[model samples]
Target chain A: MTLSSGTVAPGAPTRTATGSVTVRALRLLESFTAERPELSLSELARRSGTPLSTVHRLVGDLMEWGALERDPSTGRIRVGLRLWEVASLAPRALSLREAAIPVLEDVAAVTHENVQLGVREGDEVVFVERIRGRRSVRLLTRVGGRFALPPTGIGLALLAHAPADVQERVCAGPLRRFTPYTVTDPVRLRAMLAEVRRSGVAVSDRQVTDDAVSVAAPVFDRSRAIRAAVSVVVEADTGRPAQLTPLVRAAALSIGRALG
Target chain B: MTLSSGTVAPGAPTRTATGSVTVRALRLLESFTAERPELSLSELARRSGTPLSTVHRLVGDLMEWGALERDPSTGRIRVGLRLWEVASLAPRALSLREAAIPVLEDVAAVTHENVQLGVREGDEVVFVERIRGRRSVRLLTRVGGRFALPPTGIGLALLAHAPADVQERVCAGPLRRFTPYTVTDPVRLRAMLAEVRRSGVAVSDRQVTDDAVSVAAPVFDRSRAIRAAVSVVVEADTGRPAQLTPLVRAAALSIGRALG
Candidate 1:
C-alpha cells in the first residue's frame, strides 16, 4: 500500500537549481500532497525551502496566472483548476487513458473484476486508468498512483518490456513485499520476467495481496514497441488466472489498436 | 469548443521574462494544446517563441526530467505521463472529483443521464468530472474542459453563488448563443440567477444544445461556502426538467456532505 519510486517521494520537491524562478514556483506546487492539499504562505516556504519574500512573489505570480488559488475564508492555497485543465492535455496519460477506457470497461463488464492500465516509468509502473468492478476483489492500485514493477501483474508485464538496464537495476534487489506471496528474490523475479516474455502473458498469483490474483498482457504501438500493459484482478480462489489471460490480452490489443 | 480565458489559453506560455532558462523551458510545455497535442522540436521552438538552439537545450532538459516524451515512431514530442502524475495532486480538481464521484454515480444511476461536476474559474466554469449515463444525451462538456458561465446548468449554479463583482462582470456581457433557448439578455439572466439562489437549483432548458436540458444545484463546503456544482443532463423532450431538479439537488447536497 505504500509503494513509491526510489528517486522521490510522491509530493516532495526536487532539488533543482534555485536560480530558476519557474522551478521554484513548480516546487511550491510539488509541496502540496494528497494529505496536505492546502498550505499557508509560511508552510509553503518551509516545505519548498524558499525565502518567505520569494515565496510571496512566486505565489502571487502563480495566483495571477490561476496555477494556484487561495481560499477566501481560510487564506490557504490549493492547486487551481486551470493547472488541471492544462495537465489534462498530457498525451501519455490522458490520451492513453481515453483510448483504453472503453476497452477497460469491456474487460470489466465481461470479467466483473478490477481492470488496470499502466505504463513503465524509470524502474516503476504508474497506473494511468483503473476500473473498479462492482463485485471484484479490492485493489490497492489507484489511477495516477505508482507501484513497483515486480509484484502486480501490470508491473511485471511492463517490466518485462523495459530496457535491459532498467530490468537489471530492478533485479539487483531490495524488492518490497506486500504479502506472503509477493516476490522478493531477484533471481525468481528475473525468471518470472523471462516467462512473461516467452508466454506473452504475466500472471501474478496473489503476489500483491493474499486474496487477489492478476493476469496482464503488454500493449504494443504500431512500431511493435511495448507502450503499456493491461491487467485484470480477481478473487484468488474464484477464477483461474490462466483462464482469464486471453480476455486481458485481447483487451490490451484492442486498446493498442484504438491508440493507433 | 475553443472557450478560453482572456488572460491565457490552457497551455499557452505566459509572456513572462524570457531570459530565465526555467521559464523558457516551461514555455515549451505550454506550446502544446488540445488541438495540437503533439509537436516537433522546431514547431515547439516556433510556437514557444524560442530560438532553435535554445529549444534543443530546453527540450533536452524537459525530456530528461520526463516532462516531455518523444514518440519512437514519429519523433513527435508529447506531454509525458510524469507531468500528469504530478499534477494529479491538484486538490481543487482531484479532491473535488474524488469526493463527488460516488454521488455522481448515484445520480447517473437514478437519472440515466449525464452527471457533471464543475467549478467556477474566472468568468468561465471548468468541468472537474463528468459521468456519461447509459442512455444520456450527448454533451459538449468533458472532464477538464471549460465553458461559458451563463448557459450550462452547472455554470449557473456556480455563478449564482459567486461574488457580486463576478456576477456583475458576467451580467455586463455579450453572451454567446448556442441555441434559441439560450438566455442572451442580461435582465433575464439576472433573474435566472436570483431564482437559482432562491430555489437552490438551476434548470437550463435547451440552453447549450437543442436536444438537451440540464438541472443543477450548488455544492457547499463545511464552511457553508459554495465549492462546486453538480448537474444532470437529459434529452430535452424525453424528460421533465422540473422533476430532475430535486434529484440533482439531493446529489449536490450528498457530495457536499461527502466533502466534509
Candidate 2:
C-alpha cells in the first residue's frame, strides 16, 4: 500500500538551494504507510534516499523529540505518540471528523452503508474519516488515504467546487478505469461534475467498484466554500441514489454548520 | 498555553546561520495551544518574540503549506489538517489507544468508573485516550493531556515497569500534591512502586483528588516491554483497591492480547 522509497510525497517542495533539510526530513516521514508501519534503519535510509549516517542522525533527533521510536526488540521504527497528540489539534481534520462522526453514524445506522468524509487536497480527495456499517458494500478507500478527484461520489462533490483550473486539469486526467462504468472520457466527466454543481449532490454509481454505489454531497464552510464532502455507499443493485441524496445532503449540511 | 514564537516543531530544524527567520515563523505556529486554538498575527509575533514582518512572512509559508490556516470568518490562525495528516501516521499513541479502548470501555462498563489509557512520555504520563464512565468521579486528566508520572494509578503501573534509574529520578522529583492522600515522601513512593511491581497492579486511593481512587495494570508488547497502562477511576470509598486490582489487571491483559 506504500509507495516505494525514492518516491517523494506530493506537495514536497523542490529540494534545490534552501538549507531546508527539515522539510525533506518530513517528506522522508511521508514514506511510512499503514501497510508498512515498521521499517528497519536501512530500509528507512533506502526509502528516504538519504545516506545511512544522515538517516541515523535524523532518526536520533526525531527519537529524542518523541516524533519517532524504535521497537526495542525488532529494532524497527514506528511513529511516536507525541506526534499524534500534536496532530489531534489539526482543526480542519479533527473538528470535521468530530462533527461528521455522529452524522456518519446516523447514516450508517439507517442505510447500513459505508459512510465516508473527504476533502480536497490538490488534485485529489483525501478521505479524512470513515465508518463501515455491519452489512455495507466493500470500499477501496481508507482513512487518511488519497484518491484522484474525478472517480468517486465524494471526489466529484469536491471537484465540483474546485477552482476552474483544478477542475479542468482533472477533466484532462488520464483517468484510471476501475470498472466498465467509470467515466474515463473527459467530456462525460465534465458533464458529471456540472450535474454535481447543479443538483448539489453527486451520484457515483459503480464507478469505483462494480458492486458499490455512493451518494455524496458538498459540505461548505462559512464562505460557502466547499470544504468537504460526505457520502454513503450502499449495494449497487436496488441502489436508490436519488432517495439517499437528501439524507447525504442533510449530513453534509450538519457538518457544514458544525464547521462554521 | 503556547511557548515562544515560531518554536520549531518536532520535525523542524532551525539554523543560527541564516538566522533562519523560519525558526521564529515556526514559533508562530506553536502559539496556538489546545485552549487557545487560534491567534492573530500580532498575537503570533508577540508570543513568539519575532518581528511582525518576519511573523507575516513565516505565517505565509505555513499557510501556503497548510500547516496553519485562517478562520474564514475571524481570520484567526488554527492548526491545519495537513499537519494532522502528516502526524496521524504516528503509530505509537493511536495503536495503543485502539488496542486499549475496547478493554477500557469494558472496564468502565463493569465498574462505572473513568477508564484511561496512558503511556510514559519523559517524566510525565500523557493520556492517549480515555472513556469516561457515567458514574465515575471527575478527573483532572483529559485525552492527549500530560501529567506527572507518580500519583495516578496508571502512572504507577507504567512506572513500576520502568528502569531503576527512571524510577529513582521520579522519586527524586518535587512531586506535586493534589490532595492530602497523595504520597509526597520519596521513601513511601518507592515502597509503593515496589509493591506495584510485585503485585503486577497499582492502586491509588484518593491520590489525585479527594473523591477518586484508581486501579491500574500494565499493557505489555509482544516483547514484554510495558507499552501502556490501563486504569479505572472510581469513588474512593465505594470499592476496595484490592478488589479492583483483578478487574483492572484483566482489562490490561485484554489489551495486551489485542496488541499481540
Best by TM-score: 1
Query: What tens digits encode model 1's per-residue C-alpha lDDT throughout B43-90?
Result: 988898788766765665566555677775677888877667777877
Chain B TM-score of candidate number 2? 0.87
Model 2: lDDT to the true structure: 0.76
lDDT of 1 by residue, A7-61 (tens): 1323222234542345456667778877787898899899988888667666765
lDDT of each: 0.81, 0.76
Judged by DockQ cut-offs, is candidate 1 incorrect, acceptable, medium or high? Answer: acceptable
**Candidate 1, position A168, lDDT:** 93
Give fnat for candidates 1, 2 and onward, in order: 0.39, 0.30
Which DockQ value does candidate 2 get?
0.25
Give lDDT tens digits, candidate 2, residues B90-112: 66665666677667756766876
Write model 2 residue lDDT over A1-260, tens digit each, in one string. Answer: 11122333333342335323444444556668877878887898998788886576556545544556776677688776666676677666767777777688678768877899999878888888776676778788877778877779999999998999999888998999999999999999999988999999999989999988889999997788878999998888876767898899999999888875
Off by over 4 Å in 2: A1-19, A53-64, A106-113, A237-246, B1-29, B50-66, B69-76, B98-115, B131-139, B179-181, B203-215, B232-248
